[model samples]
Target: MSTPAAAAVSSADGVAWDLADLYAGPADPQLDADIARAGERATEFRNRYEGRVAELDAPAMRDALAELEDLSQLADRPLIFAHLLHAADSSDPANGALVARTAEANSQVRAGLLFFELEWLALPDDHTEPIITDPAAGRFAHFLRKGLAFRPHVLDRPVEEALEQKSNTGSRAFKRLFDEITSGLECDVELPSGPQRLNESATLALLHDHDREVRRAAARALTVTLRSNSKVLTYIFNVLLQDHNVDDQLRSRGHPMQARNLANEISQESVDALIDACAGANGMVQRYYRLKTRLLGLEKLYDYDRYAPLEQQDGRWSWDRCRQMVTDSYAAFDPRAGEVVEMFFEHSWIDAELRNGKRGGAFSAGGPADAHPYILCNYTDRARDVMTVAHELGHGIHQYLARDVGYLQSHTPLTMAETASVFGEMIVFYRLLEGSRDAGERLSLLAGKIEDSFATVFRQIVLTQFERAAHAARRSEGELSTERIGELWMDANAPMHGDVVELTPDYESWWSYIPHFIHTPFYTYAYSFGHLLVLALYATYRRQGPDFVPGYLEMLRRGGSASPRDLVAPLGVDLDDPRLWQRGLALIGDMIDEAEALAAGRD
Candidate 1:
């Protein structure tokens, strides 16, 4: 049942990003000068419009918004630089200090300008509607309208200002500590060559090794390290949970996910429908895993075995091959997407090297709209890593195109944010699938795609469910023990696998390392939302042929100028329909069916 292990591909070993576009380095003198200039702008903004926000006419409101947008982007540059540096190497004290300084500085600037939002929030619907509809409001119209949703939740200017200023040393500091601790973890995994110490990314990467025992070793090593740091990690979790709860209570929000729902510009009912639909489709998940178990030739599948390759070959992808394939796939879709993707590779905007102290996982950071987005990923040369590159580049493409929307409106909500990335991944995925040389290779590709979909659609729901349970536990049961949280994690995960996959005891602690739970609570569901949305959209593309390209591209270009519903409406899709989500599940079912048919052909 074992596949042959291939030699590791080191093609990406020297692929480091050049960040000089952002700054010369962390110690660049201009970093402070930019911060100071942003600070001065904030003070001036506050002095100019502190008490006059509610009384401003449409033209005056438009001018204030433009000024705010300009200052906001200026303030964001240094903090973005600090964050990117710290992510590249959190172990460096200077990088860590820079993050702290920049964050505190940004917090002070936000505090100084807090009254603008508060005053706007205090305005009545009658007073705000005219300004939102006025031609004089210009590009700020959508931004103005979006602010109305926060009217009920916003605190008074003074309290909001204090909370903003104190967050640097409070929840923000603890989140950074968690990052440092997890990023610094060194897992001592035993390899056939010898005992090798690897960082979190490398350790996680080994879970896909063709050797099952190596995967088990990597899994156990991760568990042991996580257990060793359970005390601090658990403490950090509890503190953040309480902090979030306190904030929710202060803002008079009804539930744990309400704030996130509002921020995503989605209805609570729609999110409920999404989660409910996914939960209802858990039968498809268990069925797929059962099929996976049969294909892997195992009596029962373990959690670590979930990513096992069906083919005899390890299927490693070199960085050069990955770039060519991804870019060619994008180019086949549209020349513009291909060109946008090339810009990332051409400008050295990606940091793909595997190294100690680098943060685990992958992300495409959309810096200030004036500058381009930068990507960070651990490119281990696996087939899955190729998809990761496509996914992040999808985000980079969206961020790059949306710059025309200006800084304030260019960023989409988390719900719509994943649209481009997931779509980009599908474009590459189907391209690879189309070129499959044989039934076995086709099945292998399908299996990989199905598992990835499960991870995106089903696993994210589990994470969100776990967050809900933990938040509720922290509130009702007081401080939670590590065992209690572990139990909650298991409870949330149980429905997804059912009897098909046996989740080992060690899998409980696996939840400890997820950065999203620490960085942004309730952020996990957006993955599911975006994935299902893309699945449906991809189906539309398949059906419509060449006609679908322009609408899709125009949708991305629109950015967050409109609500998520309005933004995607041009594509002739309904977000609120329960059946739309079911269609996505049906597409997943079709993938599993195709995989099963291919598996039978191999016999």
Candidate 2:
């Protein structure tokens, strides 16, 4: 089987990311010097342009922006490295200290620049509009729009600074507390061999275990552990909710999700349309589960069975084979994409090995605007691992193309950021399907891809629905008991999964572990939106051939410079049309139909 050790490092054409590019080690002298320099630059900027932004000419403003961007780019390395290292080994005290120090320094630097935008906002439209109209400033239109959107939300300078200063002690402190408590919990579960202690990563790994009893035990242990700490989790929820409510009230936000939508730069209608479409596809997900039940020879699938491997006894891919497979798949899609994926393999940009204290899951960190993006994954050399490599490499290439836009516009909003990743997966999956000669192998691949779509689209919708209900219920009825929160979760998920899957009673506590609900409320819908959007985009690509790449690259190149509507409009895709989402859902339904047909033919 694909073992943790095999994924420790990547090798392609003898190149690697050389994280040493950021720092020789955590204690490198350059890191310390960079931190000191960032502080000095922040103070220098404050003294030079804090209150005089309105008086500056276009050239002078551009110079000031360049300086700010340079400082931000310098700070990026230390901050990203610190956080990445900490995530890889949260129990390491040294890394933890590094992360804390970096955060404090970065916060100070950010506080110094707060007045730059605020002062610009204070300017008359005549002064601001001309600057915004200038070709040089055109790239910053979205950034400017984002600042203006928060004009009403901006408090007076003193109030804003005070709030920022107290943030670490308030909401931030509770966040850390929640993380520590959750990460440190060790659940004892009975395995086939014997009882064992389950850590955060191990608990998730159980969901893929072949033995049904092992998966069930793991699920039970997780629920029981979470249940034991529900009160503390509830308090964390209360503090974060109240914190947001107070801020929203002070800022006069129309609704709880208004600020989030503003930050995402997506319209409320767009999100609603996506959610409604996914809810309409609930029947499809249920149908897929029924198919899964018949394949597993079970009367009813359970929650734990949702992620069970399609072929329980299948051999795992060796790390080398996994890398080759992913790169080959990419080459089949586009030579340019294959080159980007190859760069990641050769450059050691990926840290794919699983280890003790290493963070669970995978993420692509956008590197310095001037540098390459870095990917971290706890790869197990499974098919999913290869797909993840493809997924992250997509983000890397997107970042590479976007860097041409310069620092200010290189960052895409979270809503559209998943586009390249999901599209990459589609490319790889299609390549696999076409190359497979055996019907069984093709059916397995199709099932895997459909399950991934369900996880990203359907699962996220359920989470968003659960968060909406939980937040509203909390506001109207006071703090939710652990039982009440579980009920809300089941309400959202049970119907989506249907009668083919039996949700264990303890699955209610599953809501407590979702970091997105706490970190970014209502953020789950973005995944669904991105998945559907990519499905549509991929379909268009298949029909249009080579013509689609330029349009696809152009969309990524826009970064956060335009609205989602404008970004997709060039390709003749409309985000406002609910039918587009339904179209995406229909594609997934079609795949499920194919899988069922193949299965029936086998019987």
Each candidate: what lDDT? 0.90, 0.78
TM-score between model 2 and native: 0.93
The candidate that achieves the highest TM-score relative to the unseen native structure: 1
Give Cα distance to truth, residue 327, candidate 1, Å.
Answer: 0.9
lDDT by residue for model 2 over 380-463, one digit each (tens)? 546776787778877878887788777777878777888888998888888888888888888888988998999899999999
Q: What is the lDDT of residue 552 in candidate 2?
A: 88
- lDDT of prediction 1: 0.90
- Model 1, backbone clash pairs (residues 3+ apart or across chains), number: 0
**lDDT for each residue of candidate 1 in 42-112, tens digit (9 for 90 to 100):** 99999999889888999999889989999999998999999999998898999999999999999989899
Q: Which segments of candidate 1 are over 4 A away from where they belong?
A: 1-9
